[model samples]
Target chain A: MFDLQGYGPSLLAGASMTIAVGLSAMVMACILGLVGAWAKLSASYTARATAAVYTTVIRGTPELILLLLLYYGVPTLVQDLASLAGYEIILNFNPFLAGAVTLGLIYGAFATEVFRGAFEAIPRGQTEAAQALGMSRFRVAVHITLPQAMRIALPGLGNVWMILIKATALVSIIQLDEVMRKAKIAAGATHQPFTFYLLASFIFLGITLISSLVQRQLEKKAHRGVGQA
Target chain B: MNFTTMLEYLPQMLDGAWLSLQITGLSLFLGFLLAIPVSLMRLSHLAALRLPAQLYMFYFRGTPLLVQLFLIYYGSGQFRHELEQIGLWAFFRDAWFCAVFALTLNACAYTAEIFRGAILAVPKSDIQAGKAFGMSGLLLFRRIIFPKALRIALPSYGNEVIFLLQASSLVSIITLMDLTGVASRLVAKTFAVYEIYILTAAIYIAITYMLVVIFKLFERILNKHLRTDS
Candidate 1:
């Protein structure tokens, strides 16, 4: 057995931090995704245009750059605005919050596309029928649109989750105590970069492997009684 | 807001942009070339070939590229004596080599999967047609399979190339002066963090847009014969 030099506990802690950051970011991404999908589907020109621009700009740029901008740039911007108002203020974004929010913003653009596609794939007739039956728009969304769209969006959302988890590794650049950062510390201390990085990769591979299995189960449950005899 | 500072940094940023393109272009070309054989191995009937191919894809596709880069770059230092004895330490010592090496390995895994899917999607009827015409082996592949699979894989391959381009930014972490690296350095010197990064983001966006446009044009050219215009 390879010697971890008692760094095993810290690595485990770091792995949990990675998962926590990823889940929190997933929550943020899901909220933005829903609002984005709503905006894209809305009748107003401004809402649609704003959502379009958001997805386009975010999707076109690199995630690391966005993370860096949020980490380094935002604080300066906040301070500059404060100074312009003749009130001095220092703003240092918590690294954990910055990492989660940056990942959320980057992945939310992708989730928006997934949700929009899922929403559009729902047949128009069902919504119209619900409306005709005196169901409110909210009621129609809840009873008709949401369920079917969830079934379709599940696969894409699963994909977003996978990518988002991997992107959490980038948070290590901001000095977050995620698995990658912890592994780097262990590697440096042990002079065993290969061993530690290899283990880190395995941790990520393990997450994806488990997530995919759970996703399959979710997809099956979502499709229950519909595609089978 | 500081137009003067941004203007001064523009040349350095553009130089970094060129280097980024170089790394991306070199890796994509090599990776794609390697992927053909890897994809073929993945599709092979033999368990030996397919098993290794599957593991390679799983490892590369499952892990984050940053880890892979670190493993290749810093990890090699752990075996410096072995590497030096083998006369390969020089290559591993160079950050540029490690960056490209890792990126190419990653690109190969992803591009192989794309090719595998595209190859699978090539119509069975078309392959059968080639067989009926006495085509076999390389002849069949060149005349029938390659062209069709290229068309099918073009879109995903384009996305892969963009991913590689974006992934190339990671090289900056290893101390290479790619676009992101130069931007970070500029930020450190000028303290104009937002201005430098926003400008960098704009450059990345432009390159992404250009790649998309190029891929779309390529797709149009590939499908031109399928057009039914009178």
Candidate 2:
């Protein structure tokens, strides 16, 4: 029961930044996931190859490496172009943007597999019936396929969300002021590493508990109309 | 890329890769050894054993590995004077030891869960059959439970191994000059960030692909016994 005097606001602000990164990354991942899943499931060889490479490369690399690659790596490339153009480059890439995008890219690769599995689980007969009724492929997918696939994807997606939420902590390495970064600063300032680290753990645990409950609710809603048999 | 440049960096990259592999291999080995007992504890009938095992899993799995690494590395460093007095500072003083310790603990939690699932998935009838044949306790576990659990666990354990390999890159933060660390240092020196990172990514991809092949071979070997039984 160690008290962190006057540190509450800093920790809360860090938590908010963490949440923002997680939320934005989740949205980006979802979009990329859907596209990657479609490419993977597509009949075109090039599309399938592209999708395979995306998942393999992203999944193979560590998230931190990807973060540094984007953070330090991309800025150099951008500055090189700026110098070539004879324009004064004033654009500084924020660590937060680099971190969120990197996490989104990495998580999206895993999400692609989850989505592809979910999409594959959908019965072909449902699409056939829609086609037989004169519905176009687009309409059939929109009206019949996606909604059902989402149900199967819900549990796996929930797990990915948890991983993403925890991963936001890694942004601290690149100097983003997330909870872990703030805790590190506080610990350094106050010379109480155990208290601040434990407090950070509690905040993370709290987020995990709340989000897990929300995931269960979403799973329920996603599975609502389906028969359990 | 010129052959001269590649040759110059080859030895350095190879040394880094060796360290990465050593870290991952040692952690995976130790993690699996620890996981077996933890998984058994989790499956135990006694609440006293199960509660602590469950708490261990919950806390380790719930937190990010990076935080755990920091907690062990820097947090432990906060008590360096006391650790020195106890004669344990020598071990914790090394970044390699700290990295391996944290990674092993992290992997143990996840692998234990995988093992628990595999152990439970072993058919109850199989155990009863072993008991019927006068097998009991350790004998029954050895003859029946273990083989079945290993079969079920191997695939997921393979994934965890790959994860640990990837995760070994995080050791760079604690000042271990692994592949990622080398790549970052090269970037800082040459300002050729894209080339270095792309090369590092390629190295990881190659290692990961090899692991996938090795796991597939393991799965094939494990399945051979099952096929004969069938």
Candidate 2, residues B1-98, lDDT tens digits: the string is 22345446656776888889999999999999999999999999999999999999988888888888888887887788999999999988888999
Error of 1 at B147 (Å): 0.9
List runs of model 2 lying over 4 Å from the truth. Answer: A81-91, B1-7, B227-230
Q: What is the lDDT, from 0 to 100, of the residue A224 in candidate 1?
A: 95
Candidate 2: the clashing residue pairs are none
Please give the TM-score for the first chain of candidate 2: 0.95
Error of 1 at B70 (Å): 0.3
TM-score of 1: 0.99
lDDT string for model 1 (A1-229, tens) is: 2688988899889999999999999999988998999999999999999999999899888888999999999999988888889989888989899999999998889999999999999999999999999999999999999899989999999999998999999999999999999999999999999989998999999999999999999999999977761
DockQ of each: 0.89, 0.65
> For model 1 chain A, where is the 10-residue window of minimal lDDT?
A220-229
